[model samples]
Target: MFKRVLIANRGEIAVRIIRACRNLGISPVAVYSEVDAKALHVRLADEAVLLGPPAPGESYLDIERLIDAAKQTGCEAVHPGYGFLAERAAFARAVIEAGLTWVGPPPEVIDLLGDKVRSRIAMEKAGVPVTPGFSTEEPDMETFEREAVKIGFPLLIKAAAGGGGKGMRVVNELKGVREAVEGAMREAQGAFGDSRVFIEKWVQKPRHVEFQIFADTHGNIVHLFERECSIQRRHQKVVEETPSVAVTPELRKQMGDAAVATARASGYVNAGTVEFLLDKDGQFYFLEVNTRIQVEHPVTEEVVGVDLVAEQFRIAAGEKLSWTQEELSQRGHAIEARIYAEDPAGGFLPAAGPLLYLEEPRGPGIRVDSGVVQGVDVPIHYDPIMAKVIAYGPDRETATARMIKALEHYVALGVPTTASFLRDVLASKPFRDGETQTDFIELHFKEWKGETDQDRQIALVAAAILPNGVKTLAQNGGEQQSWRQPTPWETLGSWRIGGNS
Candidate 1:
């Protein structure tokens, strides 16, 4: 077992992994940029290291600096909570070379799965179902055109280097192919530093479903079921729930099997997620494999009663999975709503300032994972996510209802959040019916202008009539306005949203 582990990321995920390490009696180490000097994870860790400046390129993403922190701190292992260098193959290999245990899969597996084209090829060789796609070291115009004709129009050009909707394009017509190809190549080069692109038959309105699978050094693997991540905005998942309403029992079996196959093919170890795009007809295609824990891992943990971070520690320590596939069963539904500091009304532009008031929901089945506290400044230097609100229950209906209630009660001060918009989503009929997909946000904002008018108006009216300090007058003994109810704030505006008083 690792006596000490360094968390190389920030925000809620860092705090999350720290708690898991503590539960296992492991000393937790945290590294932070200047902006996160007082961040929750830094405060919670048993030991802390200052990496560098606030910019990720100099701090969190600096591989050499992170390795130095590990060596100087005498950490036996490093647990990358996710993001940063979590999926970077070189980072894993470096830890191993430094005589430290890497609490993730082997470097070779990361390299193979990190490359989209190689991952697809590997899955295919392992008899896993994959989407029809073309690969070329360098594609020629004639070869591209011939392949397009055979695969049909409406194809996607994906970057071979990384996968995040970056360096990707969709061509709907023949005349658009050349332009789309050029644009995709340019974007791919800019984003991933890799100009290599490939063509694939694009599926419309695909539901994003992923299977969470864990493997151990003893050739043991188990699937922990699926997460319905179809509700997305700009390729970012806003709402994630387990027991995908779209997946039937039989389809679950098939996808689970395929996820296991993908893991086995990669010789995977530790926790990983296999993402798939499930078409309406119940057919699913392997999209890619996330080589580390996902942001939405909470939902899976809720329904399965498993602490994945703890499991990762056990697996990396050369222990086989204690539970088998048959013993794994998700008993209920879990829904998670991400709260970002970005404002949905202001074109989702990012917002940063000192947090004056921070009130998060708490109670049975409600979990709030946050990174900020009152007086801490929200910086524009990192991802805008402020916290995640997750709810679990015996079924989706109960979980969704609880999450919506939690979002309403939750409050933040310094910056605007997506809380209300998330509330609207939970109330929408389409979401209730579980009929969302990757394009849900486009579909959400298509009518967002007029649809949110009432909510906007109601919020305004409530504020005007019931400002924090505004009082409701009451008469005593037939006297007019004898007493009043006073609130903490008498003003209503951006400034009143936060204050120590």
Candidate 2:
């Protein structure tokens, strides 16, 4: 067990890691940029160090600075929570060279699996089915063109070292291959510093499913079942659920076994996810491997009743896995909705402003993981995700209903959010029938505006009441002094007793 651990990230994930460390009796050390000096994660950690300016290149993404901070803070281990330096193999190696435990997979494994082309090859060698694709160190346009024709139309041009939908493009016809390939190469170079790109046949109506797998240094590995992440926009998942309604008991076993095999082949350790694209015919193909804890891990934790973070710590400490495959089983369905500070009406552009008023829902089977607090400024310098709302229930219907209710009650003022859009998607007929696919958002929501009469009414009421010195609903509980002086109603404007005006 580590006496102290440095969390080299920010936002809700940092806060989440801080709580996990505390619960395990480990003091958490947090690092934050100048803009995040007053962030929730910094406030909650036992100790915090200033990184640099607001820019990620100078702050959170600085590997050398992160290592120095951990060593100087007397941290025995470093936990890179998801983004920033989480999947950077070089960072993990740096942490190890500094004599601090890295709470993730081995650096060599990260390097191998980080590259999409190499990972696909590894999965194939491990007997896991992968989509037909072309990969070459020296990318020749002619070679790519030939491969595209063999793979047929509607091929995907993807970065060899990409995630989050960046550096990716879809070519529907032969005429678009050259333009798509060149564009993908440029984007991939800018985003990942790797100019390598590959082409794969795009399976139509594919459901994005992922299996969470854990491995210990002792060579023990097990898969924690699957998460249905097909509810996406721009190739990024917005909503994720566990025990996918699409994956049956038999299909679960097959995918779980394949996931475990893939992890073993890559010499993986700690936590990682094996993502697959499941077609309508129930055939699944390996998509990619995420070498760090996923953002949607909570849904798996809710159903499996396992504290994944704790397990990560245990694995990094060289302890054997606590639970065996036989001991673990899914209990119920869980759904997670990412609440980002973005406007769905404005083409889902990121919105940044002070969270004038913020309220998160709470109740049985509902969990809210957040980093922002009321009055906190959401800067434009980072990801716009403000929080995650997760709900668990005995079945999918109940979980879906709970998520809708939770999204409805969630409130944030001074900045628009995707809460309403998430609610609409959950209530839509396709989602209700479990007809989720990779193109769910594009197929159903193209040109779909989110404007609603309820939103207008709420805005009108808020505008009409706020100027009258009436505090917003979220601000009513605390002791507040009215900024405005006595109004006409409070002074001499009120009717006498029951007399009419």
Candidate 3:
């Protein structure tokens, strides 16, 4: 095992990696930008390094600076949690060349699976079921036109090099294929520096399901189970849960087998997620493989009782997988709701401001993984996610009820959040009945407006009465003094719909 590891990321994931390192008696080194000088991850780490300014190009995304930080801090490994350079093969290769263990799959494996077209070809040869698509390196409009006609209308032009809905477009008619392809290519180049795009058949109203798979250098691989990620907005998942109501025991076995096959075909090692789209007719097709730990990984861990981050370290240290496929079993239902600083009513547009007051829910079967603290500024420079609220229970109903209560009790003033929206989602009849398809939001909440009359009134009262003597909390201190004074907002007392004093 490595004596020390450098976490090459920020926000809640950085805090998560720090805790994992402490569990294994390894020192965690955190690198931060200028804006994050007082971030929670930096405070929790055993050591910290300043990369550069707030801009990612010179800070978090700068491969050279990251490698230098690892070397200077004498870190034996680097863990790229989730986003920003996590899937970049060049970054992984650079870490390995610097004689530091990269806590992920080999760079070659990342390179192969990072490209959608190449991964589809690999899965096809491995006998894995993939969605019908047309892809070629030849830049010919005639070829694309012929392929689009054969695939029919309502096909997708997707970026071959990246995911997360970037560089993706839907063409409903043959006449729009060329323009869509050009737009997709331009977006792909801007996002991933790769101009390659491909055509794929669009499956209507399919459920987005994914399997969490792990492998080691010792030729052992296993799938932990599946997560239902059908509740989404703009192609990004907002709610995720395990023990998908749609997957039966028989279907689970089939998808599990296919997920394992996907890892084997790519010579995968360490933690990775194999995504699939299940049609209404019960047939499943491969979506794509995420080469690093997913944002929704905690839901899988809560049910399966596995520390995926710890497993990543073990595998990177050349240790074989400790558990077999037969030994693993899903015990209960777990659901996660991502709390982003955005407005659900305004099309989920990102919002940034000071966190005047912050409170997290506490109880059995409830876990909050958060990055920001009260009295801190929410930067607009990066992902707006502030925390993730996860709930676990013996059954789906109990879990859903717990999640709704948690979101209701959670509060963050001075910025908008999706907490109330998520609470409504969990309480809705369609979600309760397990009708979570990819278009769940489009069908149920096309014009949804959050913030009830009472809630809005409370927010207004709280903001109006905030005194000028508001003092920011002390950095690296245990005790904090409340800056609020006597006001009518305080008369409303704690345990309101969205917050407490």
Score residue 406 of candidate 2 by CA lDDT. 95
lDDT of each: 0.83, 0.88, 0.90
For 70-90, candidate 1 gives per-residue lDDT tens digits of 887778888887777898888
* C-alpha lDDT of residue 105 in model 1: 89
Candidate structures ordered by lDDT, highest first:
3, 2, 1
lDDT of 3 by residue, 132-179 (tens): 999998757889989999998899999999788889998999999999
Q: What TM-score would candidate 1 get against the native?
A: 0.88
All candidates: TM-score:
0.88, 0.93, 0.92
Top-lDDT candidate index:
3
True-structure lDDT of candidate 2: 0.88
